[model samples]
Target: MDTNDLPFKKRNFANRFFDATVWDDFIYRNDDIVVASYAKAGTTLVQQIVAQLIFNSRDDVDVASISPWIDSVYPDKRSKLNLLEAQTHRRFFKTHLPVDALTFSDRAKYIYIGRDGRDIALSLFDHQNAARQDAPLSADKTPPSASGLKVLAPTQTSACDYFDTWLERDGHPFWPFWENLRSWWQVRMLPNVLFVHYTDLVADTGKQIERIAAFLELPLSEGRLPTILANCSLVSMRANARLYVPHGAGLWKDDGRSFFNKGQNSRWIDVLPPEMSIKFEKKAVMELGIDCARWMMLAGPVANASVG
Candidate 1:
């Protein structure tokens, strides 16, 4: 039977059961590396890049299968544990759960990816908008709208609320992005943990990929490195997303496009209003120790703020 065709119940147990099972039980072989990132903070991009670094060749290799998003609300705890226990190869699992919820094991290398929160906020907005209208139809977390454009004002919810609300309160399955980012960021100094910035990845995919490869002790062939970089490029990945997104496993309405949207930094340049930008900047500095002036320089000047 096709693994993709498995009964929905058996296929996705975690979401179905919700009775948190022992996730570690699925480890067939212990891996020295784990890549954790906030939603759309280049999680899939990093996964594909890491998979290529370790395997050297993408041929006949299903990148999705190798870097499975285990914590996603599909595989029940027992099933998840079973899968983890059954795997013998070095693995690279993906997760967005806060660190507190993660079951830590010594020796595993953990890499966390963080982006400027403003970009993250915009990405979340776009992603949420897409999910509301997309196929397989996940719940629409968007606030009701009269103009047909979902509007989320400050009075509504937080930057995290865009997806966290759907995943937790509405029982959508992915891990919460903000909590997960904070959880990992807090302990990034740990010997086994590495923190990567999304902007860094955008600025230099090749360099960042090498950094990740070295962290995992994975050797990349001379020719293989470039190939991997090209394949995981935003354009290529989006063009060939079927190889990565889980839902694209079969020939269903899956587009070979990547889940990654607007790979550029400062996409918030087009999305955030001046007042909201100030509010977000102040919040980020207060909450993340990231100064607004410094971050704005990184994200690019706010048009209104600069003039006034």
Candidate 2:
């Protein structure tokens, strides 16, 4: 519970897209909320959920501007730090870096979201493909140069092939999946950190939200659950994509529906080769051990379904 026991700054993480060093300069507040995830693992969905909770069910919470990716190596990145320092509202934001790369604070609450590597490969393929087609940075879109990493063009024509490269390269052209997943897994025992699975969020959003709300010590207003559930639903988010897509990166499409693609789990069942899946299984277990890996990909007891 003390700062000394929190995850330490063990290393720096940077790619063309993320810069963990950006966090070194960030000053922490007691009530800050940090949403951490390895890319495309429902980071934004939780952001949407948190926004609804913090704003008391009002639907227009501009999460994009308000919940900037604190560690993004985006343009004017330092200015974001300045802006965040100036914010007076109970501030929250997102980060794609692993726990080891971040400047953790005992006073701040942390939420980490995880998804199966197989599903992430498919989702990430769609996400990157859409980015290549888009040309502007609205309040919602991230520019090609944002992450500090070089632009990675889609090398594969299909999601299955993409999965092969993703598994073989370990999140190639983006970032390392195992390291990021493992780093967070190492800290799962921390009292200040909360892990959420993408499947759990999609399977029973109401229960998940209640868990997240409770973790952040937010009291659920009577009858607000329905509104929170409705707003955070994939259908609702896709229908009102503009509102949910965070600033610097929402969707490049005019409809923004591409960002929320399917929102269902296990889209990789028939798509990826079974052999490749076996490889991912070994990697997940090797990287995160069986217990953490199971809780992350599936959900339930054995750390299976606890929002804690």
Candidate 3:
């Protein structure tokens, strides 16, 4: 994959990290909204949620077009700024880069999604494999330069390779999961931005959708709220997956299915080995301060007294 295609801005760890020159035109306007997150963290899932709410739950709109992905790839920097400047009913966009790469528009509201690293590992694995399947392959099913360890394309590798790389200490496309969440977690406390958890969305999509609408201050008619809630559910989103295509700073091909996968959480319990689970848990505790091993304390299988 060509690194130039990524939408990331070049930066050295200095000068407080500002580069408005690249995306000045694409900065948020009064009507613009941002659905941002780390990859495999439900960026598309919440984009659909917001889109449905803004469109008044209309089924006729081309969601993908209405909510363009303004990442480093789609419109590039110049085109992205151009899109940001243009007027529309609302400007909806997706992003996977961390907060440092993003431009904070004081007036624009940002919605960030957070998910478990285990599910992210699984989802990312599937995402990479799907892309590799689309690329031209050798008889043995390897890309041209990726046959050996020398080639380090995310799209050219398997799930295990991606997971290993992601879990490692220092590598390109840095995991930075811990730092990413903490930075945005801080931003979330700001008045304009909202932070959402993926598990909550899965468990109670309806309520989560309502919370989203409330955050955006988008009014929802009584009937429309239910409609948007139903449409944005993982089941509904997966069934209508064809409506969303790949766009962004990555080479995910144009595969629409890439956005909506197994949507279930805690899948690592099924596939992750004992040793790997321990390592992943340790890293999560160290990096995210959440112990996957004992996360059940908050997410037990049993219903709480209120729900029960």
Candidate 4:
């Protein structure tokens, strides 16, 4: 494909949590790795995995600090750019923006992680609750516009209600879930984009890590493999949770450990009613089509696994 022919469309999106406009000022490097996902879709996990691969599985590395969320308005565009510009390593950054809202670069490699929306809804509930708890403390200290931070008020009382709101309203407290998934799914065939699923990662982390490493063309020695796998494990990530939590422990309800809460899938299996589950599945099919929806729901073999 012609580099110039690659799709590029600028858009503006803002909510309490994200400012997609931050990408407007982002400077992309040829070797840059962009990690994109909807909320609570194992974004941090992928970032941890990428950081481990780039750093050759160094346990002490601050993954959160090193892999900054460039689109976050907390530190502002100038501050993020300054930090990114000074980075000597192959830089990887985090974003939750949809494809159109971003400035696409043919040179950069993008890793897009997808999780079942049912699972994401449960995880998002905990995340929002934690943020609400932390909001008051930082409300006076941190300027509102600086972070685009707003304490997310719970729209529903229970997990079932929360899932209903999430699916019906389309990723309430964040952006539209369907659009975000569909936008990235459409670009899965792009050479620079790698599609990852949370279920697949959980099923075989080492295999997924190898896939990621190969996609990024990282030279992995047999000796370094064990360390990389070890560091990216759920236990290790949760144990060293402070280093991986965004904006540090102070911004979380339970001092950041809660941010890494139960990296398990199918939690919604018990929580959501059968009808609600059926509703979500139907919506998924409507938004993402049968192939992508099935792939996303199962997180199994990719339906269209042609991209490098």
Candidate 5:
């Protein structure tokens, strides 16, 4: 496919953490891999899986440092590009931008991991609470954040309150949830795009990892599969949680080791108000349509999944 015919950046996206235009300067390689997600949507999990596949189960792969978040405004543009250019290995990076916000390329493979919005909300609540008060803590001296938009640690006192704000404001402190998910969903059929839901990953991580491997054209060897699976597990990742956080710069509270929370589904089950649950479902359908909204919280026909 002609690179000219591929999807390029449609719009610039700036938020507290990202300057989407940062990707514009990147030179895409056909073998490059980009992991796309809307934060806390099993992104690190996918990265860990890809790292395992790429290294064929290297035990000490420091994924966060190696696979930099290209869209982030931190570390400056020159440094980010320089790191990528210097890498001799097949490079894979992470992004929180929607497909349209990205300088998309057919040359690169994109895998998007989505979770139930409710689950993401619950997960993010825990995540943001642990962040430094100044927010997005950086141990090193760094340039100002993207767009100079200052984001403080979340002030919401309760999980329910946080959910209300997250839903009402359309991912307020972060990016738009529906649009990010919808953006990837629209281009999901693209040859380079692969969509893997959180439920699917939770239900059968090994299978999902295999599917990801197939998509990236890097099939795992039989012996590497177990090691890859073990490394990508929540237990394994949680134990090494400090290594997975962005920059591993003590961005998280208490050394960022607790970054990986319970990797289960329906965390917002009985915790959310009945009306709030209804509100989320209605908005999800209205924003993402029935198919996607239904797909978002599929733990088994509303039996296992409360949000459904």
Candidate 6:
């Protein structure tokens, strides 16, 4: 299948959090790995996993610096491009943009991670709150561009209020949630694209790691599996937070540890109302169809579930 021929819409996503257009100038290499997610999913976790795989489970790799978020608008485009071009090692990058927003390359491997929207809402709230607090004193607080595109705003502290805003606004301060999932889901069968659910990672990390390794064609020695697994653990990631935290923890008020807060899913079960939870599920079904939605939320078996 020719991915370039796939239908896509060009968007000027210049928001406080993301800029989709930065991808237009990106150059793809045959060995490049693109780690993607809708915000606060397992993007960072999988980045760490991919870093370990590429570096043969080395602990000293600075993933955050090495794996820049290419689509981010904060760092200038030329600098990021130059940094990537200079890299000799197998380059892996992060992006929050959906598949359609990106410049797809058949040669590059893509790993898209998904999580329950409820959990995402909670995690996003924490991330936004911390980011807001970390904002520089002279930072621009002006409204986003006149393109009528809504930038991500500070999330409410109350879980219920935040959930309401997120559900009502369809990812509010961020881009649309359902469309991101649907866009990636439609291309799940692509040879270079892999779909990984957070639930699956939590349930069987070793299995998922092996799957990722196979997808990336990384040679995994049995001896290195333990180190890779340890580095990817929540505790280890938090402890070594400085190396993996985006922008070196300066973007977070409470430091990088707060950004890595509690990797556990379902923190929204008690907080999210039953009706709202049902609404999220129904919306997922409507957008992604029952099979994809079921696999996303429950990590159930899907037909022909090959990793790569």
Q: Per-residue lDDT for 291 in model 5?
A: 79
**For candidate 6, lDDT tens digit of each residue in 1-308?**
58665645466564566667667777888879999888888899999999999888988789889898887765666767889999999999998877767788877889999987788888888776766442543234323331231223355468788888888888875668888888888888888889999988888888999999999999898888899888899988888888888755755555667678777777777677767777777777777887777766663322222310
> Which residue pairs in candidate 4 have backbone atoms (N, alpha carbon, C) closer than 3 angstroms, thus clashing?
none
Q: Positional deviation of 305 in candidate 6, in angstroms?
A: 25
Local distance difference test scores for all models: 0.57, 0.76, 0.60, 0.80, 0.79, 0.77
**lDDT tens string, model 4, 190-251?**
89999999998988988898899999999777788788888888788878888898777676
Residues 1-308, candidate 3: write the lDDT tens digits.
23332234444222111123454345556746888776677787788878787777865555665565564332345555655566467878776556656656666788988876667767866765554343333212433422222112345655555666777842234345666665565555566678777788878888888888888988876777777766776677655666664432123433445456677777766666656656665665565454322332133231122221
- Model 4 residue 212 CA deviation (Å) reads 0.4
- In terms of lDDT, the poorest run of 10 residues in model 3 is 299-308
Give the per-residue lDDT of model 5 (tens digit) for 20-71.
7677788988789999888888999999888998887876788888898897
Residues 1-308, model 1: lDDT tens digits: 23332211112222331232334344434455677766667787777777777666563357665566666544334545555556666777776655655566554678887776567655765554433223333212222321121222222444455434443332233333344455575676666677788788889888898888787778865777778877877777766766776534222233534255677787666655566666655544454454423432364564445321
Error of 5 at 240 (Å): 1.9
Tell me the TM-score of model 5.
0.91
Superposed model 4: Cα runs more than 4 Å off: 132-134, 143-147, 150-156, 299-308
Clashes of each: 20, 18, 3, 0, 0, 1
Q: What shift in Å separates residue 3 of candidate 3 from its native position after superposition?
A: 34
> What is the Å distance of residue 304 in model 4 from its true position?
23
TM-score of each: 0.72, 0.89, 0.74, 0.92, 0.91, 0.88
